[model samples]
Target: MFGRGFTLSLSVFFTLFIVFLYGPTVSILVLSFQGPNGGLTFPMRGFSTFWFESLFDGVGVIDIWGAFGRSIRLGLVVMVLTVILSLMAGLAFRKRFLISSFLFYATISSLIVPSIVISLGVALEFRIIDDAIKVFGDNMGIQWVVDDFRTTMGLFSSGLGAQLTWTLPFGLLIMFAVFNRFDPSYEEAARDLGAGPWQTFREAVLPIIAPSLIGVALFGFTLSYDELARSSQAIGGLNTLPLELRGLTTTVTDPTIYALGTLTTAVSFLAISIFLILFALLRRRTNKPSSSKRSTL
Candidate 1:
């Protein structure tokens, strides 16, 4: 229906948009293979895996592996929590509750609020918790609490909460969209067949929503994995990969940093690939019986 000129213009626009989006990443990926003596700038000095090798050797004084582990663990925790809590919230909101509107807006308010602000708020809140613990320890004569207790901010505590503030809203919004378009007849048929609520959901509702849940999980894991601003002040005592990467930017002056960036980007792509694979599997499984039934008939 469109003219050839319009189509050509649209294709050119899309090509430029793709280049604009990924050009830096592609440059970093290419630069990461620079030789051992290579500088950060161009003029590719004899391409080699030296920088990638250097990443394993060490990147300055930073704990690269430890930070990676922390990010992975935190991302997994955030993923599980986001999926569960979002599913709960989505289900709860399916029926009108007294404070549903208020709660939803409150949950979504995190998206509108600045991430650094949330980080600072969580840090301050945890400092208050630490103070309370200290006071309690003094009053109760708990020597361990008094002498050994440090701040309450850590990966699973304040860090998890902050990342959730970012991931959960996205999860909830996804779930809301999924459930909104959901066919109720499936659940009704399950109920008619004498299935309990849990059984109904497990057999009918859950299967249909499985693909979307995989999407939510992808968002949860990736968002938490790459999270920096909200994780900055809240993740105490140790750092996640992104935080470490940010720190390395100031200290490390080589293609090793670019190698790190490439590795992390590879990790993100791997996560996305895994999630997409799972989504496809779930979709195929969900459709299998229908296809078989139609073929048999």
Candidate 2:
């Protein structure tokens, strides 16, 4: 399918895409170093790390550290939970069940649905949950759901739900592809070699797919880290980095916002680098030729 015509057209398209992707990144990185007296957009007013220093020192109006910390914590939580749950769901999907078709469609549906719609549904569901809890508490004469309960739930419930709607579909699909391409003979061979199920997965399956698992985790973390629409109506009390960054857009007229974007992008790159290193190590460890395949020295 890759004819000369296709190659030429694809090359142009790919080049344009790369430019589109990296243009904002480069702009943000450069502008983030604007001098203390710089304007929002280019040309360079001056070159300084004043804005970046302002990041740690809170040069802007909003709580940069607090919002940043919240975003990191939420992303981490989502990453771990997404990896484990999606792996389980992916494996479960391998075996046919009574509602397998329904579950598959439901999982796929989450991705096709608009983020705003899912966010709205999560918000409404949490509201219903709060109301139901109140009614049940009143009937049982239990005052356990104090303001604390409401506060915690407000921060976590809808936010978590909304984010899961976004992350789970992606994780599930990745795992589905991983499993579909997996060779069952490997597992059977492991079993024949007297390895238990846990042993088989640990020493056989896991090492092979560890990189993809890392990829899903990265996707989960980054998705939740930058998520705005889901956390827009879902998160209460505390705003994430993206939301606070949005707040900066209205209140501040400097490149500090670009600094924030740069910081986040740097964090994403760092995470990606770390995952790649781990993946490389795993690949090296698992890529050794088998004893039978090894050549005599």
Candidate 3:
């Protein structure tokens, strides 16, 4: 339906868009293999894994491995919580009750708010909690709480909450889409087959929505792993990988930073690959012919 000129223009535009999107990542991946004596700029100074080696050997007092570990742990936790809470919320919203619309809007409002504001709010809330604890401890003569107990803005607490504010909306939205198109006859058939509520979900609803849950898990983990703004103030005393990477950009001017970037990108790709593979497998299983039907055939 289009002319040759339009087709050529569209192709050129897509090509340029792809290049613009991935050009910097490609540059970083190429430069990450810089030799031991190489600089960060152009003119590829030999090719080796020396910069990657430098990353392991300790890059100027910063805890790269520690930050990576924190990011991974937090991402896994966020993934699990997002899946559970979003699934529950999706199921709850399936039935219209009082305040359902209000709750949904409240959940989605987090997405429109600024991420740094969420970070600061979580931080301030935790500070208030700390103050409250100190007062209570002093009044109750609890020395441990007054003296030894510190802030509660660690990885699994305020950090998790802040990241959830970013991830849960996406998860809930995915679940909402998944359930919206869901066939209710499957549940009816399962009920006719004498299945209970849990069994009906397990054999009918769950299998159909398994792939979508995997997608939600992927979104959760990836978002949490790469989160910087919401995690900045909430992750007290320690840093996640993204935060460390930002700090490294200012202090470390070598290609080792590029190596770090390449490594983290590889990790993100690995997580995405794993989730996609699982999704495909679940889809195949769900679509497979039943053994009883095959035998009858």
Candidate 4:
């Protein structure tokens, strides 16, 4: 049994933790709406939408908006690939073999290594590969890596291989958890009912795992979308939202950056809310009809 003093202490800790986490976000949102030229001062003056307006007008519709679009696209690609690779690696891991050992080690390595270190190593590797290709001039044995449009989509050939190397491990761990809990009986039952392994997985396993899969995908998407170091190194100074925000801090000391931050935070929050609501609705729909309705039938 827990003591009263312990409970009080725990409650205080949680209250402080929550406040620490959310206080900056609340402050940023408030500052975003504060008048443009005044800067963030106490005893707030009148509210204005000038920052939001300036975001569209001053930055031009192309650069900021285009970078936003590219970031979203990169995030989507990373999520899809991460999920696919994770699912494959996870399922493979259920088997006990040397292959599983290699994957296990790979996943752990990704988690252990620092992101900046990984980025630097990858960039160097790519540079070496580029040099080889240039020397051979069409007879190269193999190209190491290159930063190009494909990298924009989080592709390895485009020099995001190292970034994926980092993200895929976390993703694989998530999928491993999902697959670990999956009972073999489900597969057996499906096979007994004339379903092949692939068919069984498609109908029996995937549907059940859909929600967890989506949650993992969401995490991967957000992780890659907000990633700064990998994007900065892998793409060779190309700007994602985070990179842009950091660059903007140097010259554009306006409320617009705060506004952009607020916007990003709001969009992420709204998205998570919508996903939760939709998940609940879908779950309710999948439940069997009430006993009263069944009896009436």
Better of 3 and 4 by TM-score: 3
Per-residue lDDT of 206-282 in model 4, one digit per residue for the tens? Answer: 76666766776777777877777765676654466777777777767667887888887876776677667766664
Worst 10 residues of 3 by lDDT: 288-297
Query: What's the number of clashes in each of the models?
Result: 0, 0, 0, 0
Per-residue lDDT of candidate 2, residues 161-273 (tens digit): 78888899999999999999999998898899888988888777887788889989988999999899877888877788888887777787778778888888899899889
240, model 2: CA deviation in Å?
Answer: 1.1
**Ranking of candidates on lDDT, top first:** 3, 1, 2, 4
- Model 3 scores what on Cα lDDT? 0.92
User: Candidate 1: misplaced stretches above 4 Å?
Assistant: 1-3, 290-297
TM-score of 4: 0.85
Per-residue lDDT tens digits for candidate 3, residues 1-297, read: 899999999999999999999998999899999877889988788999999988999889988899999999999999999999999889888999899999899888999898989999999999999999989999999989977998877999999999999999999999999999998998898899788998887778887899999999999999999999998999999999999999988999899999999999999999999999999998997799778533422
How much lDDT does candidate 2 score?
0.83
Candidate 3: where are CA atoms >4 Å away?
A: 292-297
Two-way TM-score contest, 1 vs 3, winner: 3
CA lDDT of 187 in candidate 1? Answer: 84
On residues 153-173, what C-alpha lDDT tens digit does candidate 1 reach at each position?
Answer: 898999999999999999999
Poorest stretch of ten by lDDT in candidate 1: 288-297
lDDT of each: 0.91, 0.83, 0.92, 0.71
Which candidate comes out best when scored by TM-score?
3
